[model samples]
Structure formats: structure tokens, C-alpha cells
Target: MGWVACWFIPAILQVVRKHLCLRHDLRGFDGGPSACSRKGCVSLSSCSEAVSMSKVLPAADTLPTVGKKLLKGRRYGLIAHGASITSRGKLILEFLEDAGIEPPQVIFTPEHGLFGEYAYMEPVPSDEKGWRGVPIISLYGSSFESLAPPQRTLSNLDCLVFDLQDIGARYYTYLATMAISMEACARAGVQFVVLDRPNPIGLSDIEGNIPKPYLRSFVSYLDVPNRHGLTAGEVARFFAYKRGLDLDLLVVECAGLVRPMQLPDTSLPFCPPSPNINDFECALLYPGLCLLEGTNLSEGRGTTTPFKVFGAPFIEDPFAFCARLNEFGLEGVAFKPLFFVPKYDKWAGKRCGGVQAVVLDRRKIKPLLVGLCIVWTAMHIYREGFQWRREPYEFEERWLACDLLFGDETIKTLIEMATSPFEVYEYMNAQSKSFVEESRDFFIYPDSV
Candidate 1:
């Protein structure tokens, strides 16, 4: 029966792949869902026609239905940015005004500020004068202490409403801001409300190791997987449970969203979550490429396609470097050798030998694995030139950037031991599976269709 099933399944999936116009098989030999070639197509069992036709709305859109009841008597502050908009393109503040709901007494902006204009790790200027009349507070400041809302600030508000668009990477910092702010709210006796949005990378592809307890920093506030398969609301629940916080937490669920739906699956417009992440493709690549920040590599920061293209001036052979990466035979992604000059960040104004990582099939690609291979290959081929960044990252100077980004020295050890990428994948995949089992209780959305 097993032998017959294996042969039968492959033949059936091949037919289905052709029928759906899919670029890859509907499922791999391992039976995992492959990337859907059709734009806006969703899930393993569904295509564009099989999934719901309704446009997915951010939880902010449901605010009209639930906000008045929750905020009628409570003084609230909103943690949001420009991307905090409804499906119809109404900004959070504008939606609040239109819905006849009272504006938050104070608005909190994350790392990129309210409009997402600030550069990476740049301190956002706090506006006591407020934007459009509401007092604006910057959560991301120069000091590590400033990453969270002050307890004094929290005390004034009966509730703190969080509505930032998280791109589903641990190092993104917005989720960290949310988790830290939640801790502060718990301390200050404030209710925390999370206006959930879709995990833009989708919920199916959880990867990477959870940072060790000692490696916890602004970038990794909570010990979650790098590609955590949960929404902002789910993370909040997980945080509350893990920390045993005795505080009120409410999650206003998004409409027309499911675990299998990536950002493209939703008809919602892609807003750059941060200044560097300009599109959905950038966000898709961020989980692994973000590790480049801890290295000498230029993560295409100043280029037109940050995260999509990465390189450094030291890499003398672009073609050789790309050839090595492609030889790994990684799935759903391809590396094209190129040269670029960054306008600002790393290797600024210097031509760097690099490669553009093009996503051939989004769903099938393991971005973390792709990123690991890039770094590993570079380290292997350019041993004389490649270097791990030693500068202070996320305000800590104690550990190397790679160690912090990876959550431990284990990855560095693995690379130093000259282990294969598959071995590294085995280690990280084991950790990811453990995280899934532990975090399952906190999941608000169903994992299956």
C-alpha cells in the first residue's frame, strides 16, 4: 500500500500542478506544500478559486465593531505606524475619526517612527507636540532602556493598543517593542490590546533557532523562533503565558485571514513595515538576510533592493560567489551574481561583488536556509575576506552580531566546525519543532484549512 501510494501521489500531484499552472510540483516527494505560482493563490489544497474571494482586513478594520465597547471609558494610547491602515486604505487615525471613536490620548511610534521614514536603528524623535494633535512618543531611542514605553507613561493610560504590522521575523524589533511594552503594561496595571495583522510570511514556514535566554535583547525580546508562525495577537498571548503576567490582554482578530495565507494571498496593499523593507519580497527574504547586519556584508541596504541583493567590497569574485551558492541546490530561490554601489549603508559608494537572490517560488523557499547557505558559502570561499561584525548591535557590545542574531554561539560553532548546511538545518529545524510544540497553545488561528 505504501509503495503504491508513493507512486500514485506523485502522478496525481503532477497533474494537479499542471492544472493549477504551478511552477513547481503541488507537493514535494516529502509531501510538503509547494509554492503556488498563481498570484493570490493560497494553501496546499486551494488555488485562487478555492480560497475565499474576500480581501483580508487588518484587525484595525474590525475596530469599529469592537473598539467602542472596549474603549468607551478607558484612556488609551496607540502603538502604530503608517502601515496601520484598514483594507480600504484608511489609516488607523483616520479610521478612528471616521468611526466616531475618540482618538488615543498619546500615540507611540516604533523603530521607524509613525510614517516609517527613519532609517534602520536610527533613534526616532519624540514629538511632545504630537502629530495632528495627538502626543507622539518614540519607543525606539538611543538607549536600550527606551525600547519600551516608560511605566509612568503607561500609568496614565488605562489601555495600550498595539497595531504595528510585523513582518514575522524575530530580529524585526517591532514584535520586541510589543512584548516589552506588554511587560510594562503588566507592571503599570494597564490593559494591552493587540490589533492583529497577518504574519506576512505566512504561518506554515517556521524556521531558525530561538535565541537562548542570555541572548535576549531589543531585537529578540521574547524567546520565539526567528520565523515565528504566529500573528501579533498570538505572540502577545504567548508572552503573557510564558511570563505569567497578570494583566488584561485582548486580541482584535483580523478578518478573512488564515494560517496558510501569505501577504500576497490577501488582496491588501503591501506597506513597507520599516524603511528598508520596501515590498513584500523584501519581507519574504528578511528572516535570513537580516543576519547580514551582524556581518561585514552589505545587505543591499542603500541599493534599490535591500535584502534581495547582498554583497561586500571584499568579495572579489561575484560570479564565483554566486556559483557556489547556486551549487547548493536550495529550493524555490536562485542567486544571480551582480555588482552594486550602496548610497549609504555598508560599503557605501564602493562597488561590491554580490548576488541577487530571486525568489522563484515563495511558498517553497526556506529563507533562513537560503540565508545560511549564502553566509556559509561566503565564509567557505572568501575565508580571507569574510568577517563577522564585532560592533555593538541592538545596543549590546558584549557579543558578536552573528551570535546575537542567531541567539547563541552554537551557529558560530557549527560554521567553525565546518559542518554541512544540512547539519545546521537539522539543528535549527529541531529547535523550530520544539518551539511549535511549546507555542501551540497560544495560537488563536487554526493551522489547518
Candidate 2:
């Protein structure tokens, strides 16, 4: 196994070179590192030997059956929002089949859709699936706000089962779906069941500030950390408990899951549920750069590489842009200069100067801070082209898109005012203040990453 786990580039580079042509069977390819930036990547060996292995998931061995937990007769709703074969979610899906539990009348899905087939920003429509063609309600689509279905849609189902794979970012929307769904279940008088999955970003230290209630969009429904250190089951329980919703929620906790472990080894396959986000590396940076969705600069969307490398048609000097980023000495990674044209998203066939994110040290990078620089620099260097996306984002009519993402307008306004990093940090403290206090009750796990 690669000691680097899934967060370091050097370790991955070294391992890749050592086994470059050693054999068809190179060890630790999938296990080496999770995700890294391509901005300042000096590892030449990494670019040359990029071979991906297809991993097959394990068959279920000892999944918990419904008969084991239920009192012979109990109704429940199965929320399978975090659907990925790698995590324990597969076990839960199999459990539904193996656990002698009666068929759930209603099944709810989170962001990324049922099979994660929907593109990012595109809402999934309500659909049906299963061997017998079970109805798959799209919680991400037309009725994404709450879990209430036609009393007829959920009429057959008496209980709710919630299980999905979350990448641990506040604006990711899955958490919001979970919260709103819980509320709906509460109102509909349904029992909710939650099967948990670990936060792939790990339950280490929380980053960034929580979004204020007013800043709350579909992304941040509550005061959870940027990279919330809780599982789906735990977060659901927290909502049910703390929010004091009169919903009956139960969690089927995982026995083998743990914190700090990145994907490709979480016992699952990779699915590009959303566009631009294909792996853990992109996911790691998503919490921050996703804010660019509100900006005119291309966050590398509409191309082979998205989010990892962002540039606009006007960015004439890629080198100088990277220089500004390096001056910040952003931790855990370095920037790599590159130039490319997008076939779709922003530039669309026109050559644009940009750098690919090169993750030098995966464990140490401050994605939010780095993302701040990326956005601020866009405004600084390409002031002419830079503009905030206006109009209702995810339903907020007048609120600025950047504000909802950062969870506050201070960061957005601070950048507008060219605030220094030190000043921004202080501002984040205030935005994050209430989070620390309310989290006292939400800390379901010990302070050990």
C-alpha cells in the first residue's frame, strides 16, 4: 500500500516512478494519494505515466438485515442520497435486499442524482428504477426543497432510509437535501432511517466559517463546518436531535468506517456524478472554487479540466498569475503553469492562458484560502472581465452568489475592497463564531482525526 494515502503528490510521484515500467501490476496506484492540484506540479514523472486501474467492489459479507433491528413490524423511510459503491452505502443498498425488511414505499436521492449520472448544477428529475422498477424520487429536482412527495408517492412507504456518499463540503447541497427531507418526513409522519458514510475529506479540523442563516442556500442549511466532520447518519441524527424536529430518525452506523481516509480505497468506484468534479482532488478544492460559479472568470468549466485549472479569455499572462498565487505560499501544494483552450464552458475553443493545479502536499493546502486568492486575483488582474454573477442562485433572488458560497458577504465585500489575507481571516472568525458554539451539541465524534 502507498503510505501517502490519498493527499500527497510527492509520495504519489515517487511511487509512480518506482513502478513506472516494473510490471503490469504496479502496487498502490489506487491507494497512493487521494487528490492534488496541478498548479505548480514539478513531478514530471506523474504526467507521463497516468494509467488508471479499474477496481471491483467487494460482495456483501455481513450486511445488517432489517429483521435484526426491527421489532417484527416497523415502518421506515430509506434516504439513499449518498449513493456510491465505494463506501458502506453499497452495503446499505444490499442490506435493503438482504435484510428481510419490507420494500420501502419511497426512496429519496440527494445531489448527483440516483446513480450520480446528472451533471453538476443540473437538477435531477424524479425517476424510477430497480429490478421491479421501484420509483426513485429525485430530491434534487423540481421538488428539491423538501422531502414531501404526493402523499400518494410516499403513501406506500411508512419509513425513510437515508444513505449517501458526501464529500464533506457545506455548499455541496446533499446535506441540505438531508435536512429538508428530514423536516418533510417529520411533517408527513414518517419514520426516517439513516445509514452512514465517512466524510472522504476526513473528520479532521473544520475549515472556513459556517454560512449565516440569511446566507443559507440549498448548500448550507445549518451551522456545519465547511468540511463538516460528521457522517450522514451522524448529521441526520444531529438535525433530528438539535433542530428538535419531531421526526423519528434512526441511524445504522458503520462498523469499519473511519475518518481521514480518502477515496479510491473507501471500497468504491469513481463516478463523475457532477461535471468538473471527477475525483477527490477536485472535491477538496470544490468548497472554495465552487464560489467561482458566481464569477465571470472560467472556473475551468466547459473543458476537459474544470475547477483544477481556471482562466478567462482575457488572462494574457498565466505566469504572472501563478506568481501571485505562489507569493501567498499556499500550503500543501504548488502551482504549475499551463495553457489550454476550452472546448465548451468558458473560453470555448479560444486559447486561454492558465495553470493546472498541482498538489505538492495534499494534507497541508488551505483550499478555501487558496480559492480566495484565485477569485480575488481574477478581480485584481482581470478587473475588466471579472464580474459577480447576478440573479437568483439556487432560489436566492437578490443575494449575491459569492455571499451564499462563502456563507457571508463579508468575504465577498472584503475582496471587493482588496482586504488583506490577515483581515479576511479575522472576518472569517466572526462568520465562523456561532458555528463553534452550536457545534458543541453536534460533535458526535471525539476530537481525533
Candidate 3:
């Protein structure tokens, strides 16, 4: 019976994978069959849009029909935002309604407000009368201390449910909010529940260095790599275990999620988690491109495609810069010379020359490595104009934004010393691997590879 079960399980998973590939006509980022098993799958190009994966559903939708029993006698709160919706287009509040649970006692919002309209790093103000008249507390207020829920606020609730779309990056800030809130929940004796979602960039790709302790701030709140490669629920587990939080933690995991599947592989509709991240490609490029926030360049904010394109007013030769970047022969990516003028933010109203990164093969792309190459090339070429941002970032005024983003001054110091890109790659690769091993203890999902 045991032998039969082992054979049957592998056969079933193979059949399911084949069905998903053929039924959805799922294609890789390069617009081809994602794997050799899917070679016979239909081309998605003929169709105007990719077919939705009916099998994949977020945790909100996977909650049991009689979920009211879980919340019947408990005073609970929700920490969510606009992107917290189910595959059926129902919001978190609506899913709760179907589950027969009453409205949350108090709602908490992250960096963006409930509707996700606020700009990057913009202070989100609390609403006394929020959606359906529940008061909304903003976790991202003016100060670093405001990044966590108050003890008094948690004392009012016995359980807190968290559901947010994470972009698979350490610096995204939502992960930080989840961690801080978990700690606050522990202190106040509140149960922490994470309604899990898929890591949009998938779970197989871990990158960059585990930040040093002193570099910890709102952005680098957890000692994870630049691309932590864990879903929100897994992150919650990691935090609770690492911080030794003595609190009840429950994770309502999503249904039909395979570790290797990226956002494009899912059936759920893309709701831009924030004002700038409008599409899957942007989310895919974000972990690396977001490092631009630490530089003087405009990371395509105030433009149609934020993070997809980057530039600065000082670059006089866009073509040369593109050629130089292409010379590195970075895998799965290409650079095209272009010009843009942001309506707001850095270099607003001034035409700036730069390159638009075209991701040809997402699976092969080492985003953090690509980002380091870009920064290094720019520094070498435009030494006079290039400068690290010294502005107050994420409420840490002492260290420069570049230092904070990279998690230490080592990368900055190396770049300043004109170290070889090969050396930088070796250092980052080693550190990233160490973090991946350390994080394995908390992973909730299985990986294909």
C-alpha cells in the first residue's frame, strides 16, 4: 500500500502539472512553453491575454465555508489593503462576509492606504472612519515607531488576520509591517494569522545578502536577502521563529500554488499593490531596480512604467551607456537606449537619457547581479555626476539610502574603491546562498527544484 501510494502521488502531480500547462496555455516570460513537458501546449500569443488558472486561488478564497467557527467568539482585526482580493474578484471584506464572520473590529493599512493610492515613501494618514465605518490605523505614519501597531490597539483584538500581495522583495516594506505587527501581537497576547499569497517572483529565486543587524530599519526589518523569495505566510513563520515570539500563529495557505509558479502562472487578477507597481513585469524587475531609490537617478517614477525604465538628467550619451551595459552579456536581459521626462520626482520635466531593461528570460535572470552591474557601470562612466542619495530614507537618517538598501556599507565601499564586478558577484552570491540555507527552516511550501 505504501509503494502504491508513492507511485500514485508522483503520477497525480505529473498529470496535474500537464493539465495546468495545457489548459491555461501557460508560457514562460519569453512567451514559450515554460518547460519541456509543456512543449505541446498551445501558444498564448494568438490569444489576446493569458488564460487564467482556475485552479489557483488565494487563501481568502480557500477559507472553509463554515469559517465563522474560527472567529465566532473572538474579537478580531484585519491588516490588509486594496490587493487583498480573491480569485473570484471578491475583496477580503467580502470573503469574510461569505465566511459568516462579522466586520473586523479595527482595520490596519500598510505603507499605502486602504486603496493603495499613496506614492512611495509617502506618509499614510489614519482614517477615523474607514471602509464600512471601521476605524483604519496607518502603520506607516511619520516616525519609525509608528511602523508597528500600538499595544493599546492590539489589546482590543484577540486575533489579527494579515492578507497583502507581496512582490518577493525584502525592501518592499509590507513584509516589515507584517513582522512588526507580529511582534506587537505577541506582546499583547494576540493571535497572528497570515492569509498567505504567492510570492509573485516565485519561491526558487533567492538573491543578494542577508543584511547586517545594524542596518536594520523599516525597509530591511528582517535579516533576509534583497530577494527573500518567501510568500507572506512563510515570512510570518520565519519572523516568529527567528524573533522567538511566544504567540499563536496560524497560516491559511493559498490553494493550487506550486513553488516555481510566478504571478503570471496564477489565475488571480493582478491588482497593483501600490501606486507604481502596475504589472507583473514591473514586479519582476523591482527587487533589483528598487535599489535605484538609493541613487540620484529617477527610477521611472511619475512615468507609465516605474522600475522598468531608469534614467538621470546628467547622462548625455544614452546609446553609449546601453552599449556598455549590454557588453557584460547579462543573461535573460537586454538594454535599449531611451529618453524620458518624469512629471514629478527626481529630474521632473527634464529630458533624461537612460536604458529600458527588457527581460527576455525571467528564470535565468539574476536581478541583483544585473542591478550591481548597472550601478557599477554608471559609477565608472559618470563619476562626476553619480552620487549616492543622502536623504532620510525609511526614517533612518544616519546611513545613506544606498547603504540602507544594500544592508551595509560594504557594497558602497567596494563600489567606491572600483572593485571588479566579478569580485562583487562572488561576495553577493555567497551571502545570498547563506541566507537561502538559513531560511529553509521556515519555508511552508515545497519547491519544484
- In the range 1-449, model 1's lDDT, one tens digit per residue, is 35764465344333321101111111312212322221211222232221243467677765555676678867999999999987777899998889788999999999989998899878998998886889999999999988889888888999999999999999989999999998899999998888888999987668777888888888777778778877888788888888899878877766556678899998888888788899998999999899888889899999899999999988878999898888888878999999999999889999999999999999888888888888887787788888999878878888888988888666765664444555565566666555767776555555433
Arranged by lDDT with the best first, the candidates are: 1, 3, 2
User: What is candidate 1's CA lDDT for residue 132?
Assistant: 80
Model 3 lDDT per residue over 1-449, tens place: 35764565344333321101001111222221232112111122222221143656676764433236557778998999999987777788877877667889999999978898788788999988888789999999899999888889898898998888999989999999999999999999998888788888888777777788998988888877888778888788778778888978887666556668888887668889999999988998888889889999888998998998888988889999999999988888999999999999988999999889999998877777677777888888999988889889989899989888888776775565534454565565565555556666555555442
User: All candidates' TM-scores?
Assistant: 0.87, 0.77, 0.86
Model 3 deviation from the true structure expressed as Cα RMSD, one decimal place = 12.4
- All models: lDDT? 0.79, 0.59, 0.77
**Model 1 TM:** 0.87
Off by over 4 Å in 3: 1-53, 64-66
